[model samples]
Target: MDTTPLRVAIIGGGVSGLSLAYYLQKQGGEAARPIEVNIFERKATLGGNAETVWVDLGNRRHPGKPDSPYRRWADLGVNDVNLATYHRLRTILGEIGELERMKPLENTESYFSRDGSIALTDDRELFRGVSDPAHDLSQVDGGKLAVLMAVVHRSAIELVESRRITPRYTVDDFFDACVATPAEMLAAAAEELGVTIDWQDPALPARLERLRHTIYYPRISAMYFADDRGPGGMPLQAPFEYYRIQEGGSPPDRRYFEHGSQHWLEALAAHVTDPSTPGPRVEILRGIEVEASLSPQGVTLTERAPGEDRWEADLLIMATHAEDALPLLTFGDGLSDTHRELQHILGKVRYTRSFSVCHTAAARLPPNRNLWRTYNIEVRNPEDTFFPYRIDYVANRHQNDAENPAYNQAGLPQYFVSLVDDLNRIPRREMLERRPSPLDGPSALAAAAPGEAGYRDRLPPLDSDLEAKAWTLFKHNVLDADCLEAQEEIARYNQTTARRRFEGRQDVCPLLFAGGWTRGAGLQEQCLEQSAQVVELLLGKAERRADPLRLVPTGSQARQRHPQARSFTSVPTGS
Candidate 1:
């Protein structure tokens, strides 16, 4: 007699959900055990916040290939994949036979607009006086201060790695363990590493402050949420272990898929759904919003479509954002106290809004001839009247690819650029819906103008050639104090649950959580790592022929690394 296949249901079909499905399918194929997998995505498309839409460059630009209209694919959501720290992502790409598709980003010289003169940055000269205090200060370029900051950053990374510490629990814990301020963050590491720098330079403080306002502030603002109380809405936390090199060096050159980052999502979706595979085939249901109720036995998901309105699974994985996933479930009385507490802990994360606008126009890019194909431009004024965030350009990557005989056969438009709006001054949906013009509207510059921090027109005037445009908005929580508290609560809960399980008592949930927001510093690589962990948990249970969704560690140190990570910590069948 054949055993019934294990049924697994995943919510939200973004990278996390897809990753779980991919691993489950792999397990079923190898173990000769049937595993049924289903992904329900609310959006019409599969990728929750990551999707691709092609831009028709119009037949006018195609010339002899007018029949093809020079169509170019644009990523509406999700951009580059950092190769150095994204171990799980790289592994997945290799497994799926897409290793060669990884393309490194070309580093171009960046510019900072200041005092009526645009200052340029050459990466080579960035560290000119980094070790020597005798160098003439007057000969330095724009990124001089950045070199010192880089040393500080390196020190922090090494400090964490040397102690074998991964502080995913809380920013407070991190700050308590490591040095507090940004300036002294690397003090311990610098001494150990034997790197020399003039920390006592007379002009160091002013230069550091300048770097903060001009570069770091805008970067932090973009990556985090706006805190009117101060810039501390999200506190700096230790970087993830996987994000740094073994030697505790800087991040590697970023890479992207030649076809666009969305290709990974599409490929995973295709893999699990391929019917030719040996194990139970994976089923993907798009354009479906589900209402789920959890009981001791399993999960019942309710939808609107006929025959698809309901689903019962032995395990339910909430792979969507906490805000979106929490509402879909009805935590009935049947749920144990452990599970309920887990819910409250997961919900503590606060997500901030994000906005990105992509447009095809040469004028949107900086007019500087020395600028690289990809670069960051920060607009500022002489009197420090407006401190606008850095706007990134993506035109050079597309143009450089046009040289390859394999791409752009139809001669697509040469320029493509995108700007990620700072949290303090996100462009209104109305403002982005129409054609973007000179920086006169309520954009970065306009919003910062009244404050008189600094001022400058970041981009050249928009001309008639602004042919195509697109925009996307989403929410992500920065690694702030609240996020740290959530991490701490979850860690404690997991430890308690683990002890109960060891005592042969009934405990833990039949659910697993996987997402960037779930843990590990909230980045794309973390999402992949979390998903891999879910797979390890489930497969370990399978080896023991135990409960379908038990949160067992794959290795000795696996569970210890993220003790509070199992979002689904209660098992109804236990006890």
Candidate 2:
């Protein structure tokens, strides 16, 4: 029996990497030997994209006194985590004993902004913001909304059922199974749902645009439609899932950690680094850029700093964002066919950039408590071209109070607005020309059209804000061409290599792949699930016992053909 520990190298220190470390440490025993895990992060902080802000609310004991602000934590990057949708994340939280920290978000109403007025909706999924209490929606419009809902429902079902039977089914495969592009599907569904309206009808185009702007973009984040310009939708070829709405829970019914998303990520980091942890000591190398190379010895990771330190590991796990990991992978002189194949597949994965601004400006924000008594406000503007959508009032004060009574006693107000802008699409020269002062308020960064004065006036005054804006790399492939090609190639690779490789050798070429981008919808749950699957693969999980009826056909004709047949030797294994 080999007792030598498996030395594993993990790239990137985000949730995916952290969770992988957590599982590797916990499940290393099943691998026949202890495991040594080393995590390399390029940034000073471990939690990538999951950033939090601790605001200092100045002293209130003596109004005129000069006292430093109290440090209270709030989220600026990833907003909320859904309990119903994110089961894997929930399980992880439970393992870390932070499950109790999860709380339900307060119910809030959404408003549509058009012609400079806000209209509240009774049914957030379908309706627009209208002033009239009894606004009558045209039958055609109502039918369109119903059809959209049906598609969303069907997509969710297909996603769940497919994953249950074929865990290897990539998200690209899910969308490929759909009937048409989201727009075309909407038009077809309308007819099926009895919506009688000409495609060229004057009102229909506007309705579709509104639906896309107010609902689809935010719900799916432009996954279906490639861009903002009407619709010359992407080619629908890959088997990818769309509009992933988890059944039973409304999308708006989301929960946020009182301390922030960073709290959860930090806790995960502590579990690996803390000396008191029960598992083998995991070394975390921060602020180091590692270049990965392959050799007969194993995986070699060379740091990019002066007098660089080199570390060799038995296995390498690229847990970073696919794009980030692609550049770090260096093919040595005797690269195997598997390494080349993986590099080709990874190249097809496309990504787009998204920019968001987080600021503390209570005066610029609308009321947190609406006349309808909702705790938060979601505002949408279809007319503003630069960044049409914005979440005006994300008041953490209300959430803090609801989660803890002691928090409310402080009576400090903290509000933030996040905008999802497609900065990558805009020209570099234009953005640079329009860029405003760093110290300036929201108006400084506003991309409003000319003569759109007073538009910035509605926003609360920006007192202080995060110095570094939230810039993110979003994995995007609308048509499924890239996803499908990647999936098929990976399927072939897995069948020949990933599945055939025995647990006897620790040195392998095709290192494990794990991230939300590799799975369905690129969500938190997908990230957790994919990383877990990688861990399971590394452990060489045992196959479940086969059922007697499963191996032999139970039909009358089949039973007659093989009367004595009970169960076959081969059994299905869990991944």
Candidate 3:
């Protein structure tokens, strides 16, 4: 019997890569031989989109307290996790013992027009004095609001129902059959709700247009789907089933980590590296870019750094964005047909760049403070209807001690994470000052006597002016029709190769792929799910399944399938 450990190389140290390593170490314990896993991350940090920074509240501490300015953790990238839908992620968190750190988030939202007008708001306090009937309506034309709500309701129902019957249904079909036909929509609404809707009202068109630009387009298309191109964008042709799985059921019960998203990511990293772990020796190589070439025997990864180190692995798992993965596949020796095909599919996956800024920029929120909610969507340029220019998340309302009166005092301090397409909107001075923490722990605050000589030296430089704090630019995968199709194609290809190996075929490619983009909506849940699937295949468990090619369900389906069942063993397996 072959006693050599299975050698595996995972490129890209994002959530997918880290989680893959964790599971590989975990499941490998049950195998006859051990597994040797190496994770190569080009970035200095482990987490890709999950970035957490310590916000130094310099000198803003409560009076009479020596720890005047305390520091708080804020997430610049992926912040909130929906407890209702994130089954796989929740399971992984439990295994790592960080599930207890989850805290509920106040996820109220408000939309604002470019001219500082409150177009729509969920804050009841804003309409406190208005009549009871008026208070219930958004700050828009009553007819327009009614029309918008009716369409949204009908469309959501249709989307869910259509997805249940037809898996290939796209959002474009939904728009054509349900949304674009306003006459039919109005008639159905009037009949179903027993309310009169005047389709012929002279001002209806303009009012509907206002609602589209201010509320519907921004909130639904841009914020929820991240389709900045609006109706004309890729979201229109994307599969509706994915969206239903992500946002379909009831409103998601959202929560954030007490210490920020980096907390759990760091915990996962620590778990894989912990000396107590049994079997599957895992090593993390940081700041190293590797070029990969594939052959029948295995994969060869050559470091792109000074030493140009190289390693041989029986299998290679790419846990990176498709575009990023495409460039790393070198054809120095030769390339197989499957390798060229994968490169072509990966090349088709598209990405767009956006800036995420963590700052105290109150100006980015609703001008009228009364309308501010946990999330504020501001339309900087109403004419540019593609997407809302800026979205500011009120970090204060969701993070540590948010309800404590001491921390809520006027002029103390506030933190906001703004997502914007244009960096010029932020002040130039605050371009890039603070660096992201090394994911170890919070950066220490300077604790020196105010008048002491070493006071200045002790403290890290604090920006007295409270505008922009820290910013990071990220590339977001554009989940349009073509991208979704490519993901399906890749999944099919992987399954085909796995089946070939099961049938004792010699020409199968040993290369595998795992990432959020591999399945439904590219969120943290999908990232973990895809990674888990890859581990199952590597462990030879795929042959036991009834359908080896079946795609794992995510969101609600995942919740029902798992039901608090631990996917991996809790005990330390091998050393």
Candidate 4:
């Protein structure tokens, strides 16, 4: 029997790749052969989307402690964690001893029109003093509200049914099939209110146009899809399931890590590399771009740079974005038919670029401070078909100590993160360089005057008119219908190849994939689940007690457990 260890090389160091390394080392002890894992990340940092940056609050001091400067850590990319749906992620946090670090957050939102009209707000306080707040539903009229509710109900029903039937349908396709037409909405409204609505009314077309722009278009482009291009664009598409998993549940039990998401990512890296742990040898290679050449014998990996040593691995696992993984497979040597087929499937996946700015930009949020919520979305152009410019998260309320009077003083700046489609909207001079700074004490801040160079260097901009703390740019995977179909094809191919190898076939595919792109909505949960499946494939399933992964209930099962639960709706509130 050959007892030599299996050499596995994994590319990309995002959540999916990091989780794969952790699981592979943990379960390798029980496998038929020991394993050695190598992870190569192009970036210096491990966390991909989970980036955290600590910002200086300038001369602001902690409440009741004048000697201490006020500072906080903010997540630039991935911030909130939905407890109800993130089962695998929670388990991984527990295994790493970071579960208790999660803090609950009140998930509230408000939407504003470009002209600063409060289109909708879920926070009840906004209507505390107003009688018939429903009458204050400015711009959102009876016909539009009726259509929006009908669309939401129909879309929810279709999302539940589409899992079994038209799984490849896009949100646009589902809307066309299930949602009522504008004419139908008008007729229904007339029948319900015992009044006639003339098709020739000059206001009718404008009302219907507002319904599409305010309700239908923003729901698809701004919120769910998160793309600048409307659903008609190829690379900006989202499948039915993508929207279903996001908006299909009751108000998510939202939480954020105490120290930020990168803390747990660093913990996972530490767990895999700890010498005290009993697991396979794991080597993490940072700041290396690897190219691979495959043949019938094995995989040969070499640094993209010249004069670099080439390493050989028996198996290769690509835990990267589908498009990114394709370029890593080199064609210097003749390629196998199976490898070509894999590349073809991978090419089907698509992605779009977006910018996230972690700054103190009050201009991005609603002008009226009273309408603010944890999530404030400003529609810069409500009439436009695509409305993607909005402040996505208010970090001060979501992650910082909002009750601290010192931080919320009249002159102090509030932290905000805006998701923008146009990079030019973010002022470049205001963007702070990306670098971690040590926490400065109050004495350090008081050492410098307002006009001194030391004060400018040590403090973040005190007012929104000045520079911001920091900014970051990232890409989001587009989960369109074509991408979803590609995922299914990859799964089928893997299963068939695995079976052939089990039957003692000499010719077998050596490559496997693990990433959010390989499964459902591209989220942390899907990324972790795919990693666990890869581990099970390499090493047989572990004993029940030793298994670190557990099955998360399906959406229907979760609903069954909470029958009285109201399905959470992001639909703008109005008449």
Candidate 5:
């Protein structure tokens, strides 16, 4: 057996794989043998979809020298984001001492639900500010009110789980299980979390319907319980699984500002890479398409440099999104049965697209407020205002002159806006041309839609063992979080993806999978999270196994992030 440093190949320069490469390099300090890692990206740039893109068809102008704030630039995709990403980012920035210079925005949502003739909003900072244990939640709607009576659900969930009230759930249980309820899962969720209905407000069916419409993001529509497994949208798990998330379970970090998010990615890249360094280098390949093959040993990689085609590694990680990876692959000539089965798994996703109209106000925005305003406007030529979904504006997303010197130079006010919720209606190019995008408006960030996911069973073609092996390697690298029985999750989707690479060292293996699709089904935050997770798996932090823990039938687009992501507990194997 040849014992050499593990030569790793990473395809896709997005967050997941990049983070994986980063951790692998850093973990080298603790490794017995040095680890060698390399990256191959199709784009000419390194950030993949996470980088800031400045696309101008003549509309990219500096905000009226201050009159129209964010009129200058626009992030093509993945901007206004979840705060859970912030927690980790904050620690990173603090360690690097760029916390103050980066100027991150820290904000949280205060939701208030209402119904017919009864509209309420949680607009008061008092709700967030008050530290009373028995405070009133009259303003808020839904069963979340009941859970809050005890403590912010997460704190309470911890108490219940520790005291054995539910005896099975804990604060760290959310992604690993599922839960559901009639009308609205909140009622069942509250009961599972040990919340008591001490106060009196039984609006009966009205409350139930109201809760259904207002509690969570209505678009998600339904909830499936963790222990609901006897059909009718239930899991066969034990009762403990139901209340686990509510009993102090924390949602992923959703507070991190993107500016801060980018800072960390950039810093990590800087820390691990140096153009002049020798050992194993992190070479970012841009604008090069994967003609075929998953590893350099299998196919030829053409680039601007002479030695670019010679790059190869013992280990290759395909961290591309599942959807994007599907088309770039070709199955082996044999094992048609297994290949066909995997096709169904890959076929279940349904993505929707949208355009983010980022605007530097045509006039100054009301000072000091980031808001979502609704308007019914009339545009030029009786066309009826370009977009009337009621603009949800993220003010001061860009730097303000008062806070950062860069904003002072731009002149006007800027707002980073994401106008979501329009998958059903397609916009004509003329519409996009007439109005402003939420990012740079008029030249919006294009439509976006995250679909659902499901699972299937299959095997790799025997004749194309090399392709099978290569795909198997890549599949292991993209297992989302690893909480799922590693073996079962791999079987669920890999047979299909691997089948695409049936021609051995051809494009079959090297085609490389990237993006959020690898995690069953990922949309926005979930996709971004998987991008981080997949990179780790590809880096060898995630180990391959023989079978899944257990298979649970899910929708065509069922997405669940595994537990073995960019996690500190299970340090990846490579570094």
Candidate 6:
């Protein structure tokens, strides 16, 4: 006899949840298992922060203003999904023998480097279609590839040697660190890696923390073009094909999605739902304001749909933010401690404010001169007067394939640049760069916090530090740090950098907690990487599988499954 089709409910239609749904569907195959998947999007549309709101339909991206951006704007920054994530995506496609139909995203292949430049990155083997083949990847000219490779090498060493990075050492002790930063951060990183610090600044601790997470989160085994650190920090390269295959045989386009990295989320959802498949159905609900509650009978989600008094779901999978979900989760589940801890953690989360200005214009990229010149910049003014962050240009992509559909999106000939500078000292400059300049919409500079210090304290337990000891030693240090003043600044600094508080907590959460926030220190790439990871995990057939529509989707089954969700209650599910 067959088992009752496990109903799996995935919340949040954003990239992470969507990726999970896609992978899960692929693993089960069409009709292989009943997966009633429901994706709940708070926004009226999908693509969480990745979605772009087209302000003016007719107006061009720029009215020829000096600082006019591209014809469109994407709030989140992400280009390519890394090799590890891409590997699973490819495997999923291969399993179904539908890999050929997949096409590379247009304008989604490159990124502007820290130095006001553009760089191309892509997996050559995975290239179903390459739009804008000649896309300008500026970092190649500067030999960023070497730096990147060095980083991979260094990460392998740290992961194998120390197993756990210590606070006093860094990898720079072994390899020459390239990415420059405040002296103190660089130094702490060096120390943690068993290296040394080259610079100063109270901000070092936060950067050190970020650097460590970058080197060895989820283990180095999952990295692309990276040899697992050998027993002696000298692991021999296996057959080059093994490494090259992971590279996707494609030339690098540091940034791949010209419109930002949210498109994959949509693509994943599309793959999961096929009318022909006889499984738990997939429902995508959007624009439904949420009120949550928890109880003895799982969880409950209630919403007011169009002309409907109430809607409900059972066994909800909170794919949204941990912070937003904190209050929404009910303590009645006997997970009250977890809820309370999470709530306190969210309170301490620190983040950054983001801003952008869009303009409509028609300009083919890659000036007639050397593509390298496209990276050249004058800073416009460094005195913190009018410009708050670095200024960059969007050049015409070098590799525009006729087969690429997004060429039209690219052909719009637009530019969108952003800046992440000293939030404390750049307001005067930021004010001058404010919006209303023929761009699409208002420029309030959306600000969001990243890390929660209170939540971070819990990491020590998750890190295995509290298992045998029964107490996390780091907690003592955190509470008793010298000059809590400097620690606060470092915390503040991180909020503006990558702006996600989730990086340090990865090894613990089996279900991926993803977004621009958790995508490592590089906010955009990390988030995309996370979305990709869930794709692999879901595809790998992760556990805790229930009806996908158990909560987020509609109908009585959902109501039965999640009677009380998102709200506190006396009926705790746990004893």
lDDT against the true structure, per candidate, is 0.52, 0.50, 0.62, 0.60, 0.35, 0.34
- TM-scores for all predictions: 0.71, 0.66, 0.78, 0.76, 0.53, 0.47
Winner of 2 and 6 under lDDT: 2
Clashing pairs in 4: none
Q: Give residue 399's error in model 5 in angstroms.
A: 7.3
Candidate 1: list runs displaced more than 4 Å.
Answer: 28-33, 58-68, 109-146, 160-195, 224-233, 238-253, 278-280, 305-308, 336-339, 361-391, 398-414, 417-469, 491-509, 541-575
lDDT head-to-head 3 vs 5, winner: 3
lDDT of 4 by residue, 1-575 (tens): 66998898999777988999888877888878889999987666666766666665555544686755456667766777776668788888888888898876545566676575446655432322232334223324754455444444443444343232233333454344223343442343344445455555566556544444454455455443354556434221243343444443564556787767767786788788787768898888876779887664568999978767788998788887787787788643444678778877887776765666666657667676655667776544634665353456777677534443444463456667777766567666544433343534222122322212111222344564333335555556665556656776776666655555456565665678887678865677778877887777667462323222212224674344223223222222111
Per-residue lDDT over 1-575 for candidate 1, one digit per residue giving the tens place of the 0 to 100 score: 34777788999888888888877776666543477999987664555556444444455443465354344555545656666656777887887777787775544435555332545443542321122222222235434555655554454344433333233333233333333243455454455556565666667656656545454444443332332222323343423232352112254646666655656676767777888755667898876779887765567899956765788986788887766666777765546675667767776776655445555544445565334335555544434433222355664353235345445353444545454544224333212222221323223212321111101111334332221224445455545455556655554443443344335453344566667666645556667656765665555432332322212124434333333224213312111
Give candidate 3's error at residue 41 in angstroms: 0.9
| Model 6 clash number | 106
Backbone clash count for every predicted candidate, in the order shown? 14, 19, 4, 0, 101, 106
Q: For residues 492-527, what per-residue lDDT tens digits would candidate 6 score against the true structure?
A: 322321222123232121122344333322223333
Total colliding residue pairs, candidate 1: 14
Compared with the true structure, what per-residue lDDT tens digits does model 5 show for residues 1-575? 32467666666666666655655654554444456776766643444444332222232255455333243333433333333334444454565454554433322222221212222222222222232222223544443543443333333233233322221222223212222122131234345566654323445334434432333222111111111111112111222222331111245322223342333445555555765433445655544555333333343333435444555454455666445554554444443543464455444433332333433332212221222111111111222223222223333433222344554544443443333234122222211121222342211122211100000012223342121110110111122222222223334344433444333333333323335444332323333334443433333343343322221223322211112111322323111
**Stretches > 4 Å off in candidate 3:** 123-154, 157-161, 164-173, 179-212, 236-251, 332-334, 380-382, 385-389, 400-406, 409-411, 430-469, 543-575
> Arrange candidates by TM-score, highest first: which order?
3, 4, 1, 2, 5, 6
Tens digit of per-residue lDDT, candidate 2, span 1-575: 77888899999777888888888877776677788999997765655656554434444454577664454544434556667667778877887777887776544434443333543433332222232333212232545543544554444343332223232333333333332234432444444445454555556545545544444443333232233332123222122232332223454335676565756776778767777777766888876779988764578889989968999887788876666676888766555666677878777666543443334544334332232212223344544333222343344532535445565566655544343454333232222111221222122112222111111222334322211222222223332345435544543454334444464433446477765456554456666766776777677662322321011113454233222222221222221
Better of 2 and 5 by lDDT: 2
Error of 3 at 364 (Å): 2.1
Kindly give the stretch of ten consecutive residues in candidate 3 with the minimal lDDT sum.
447-456
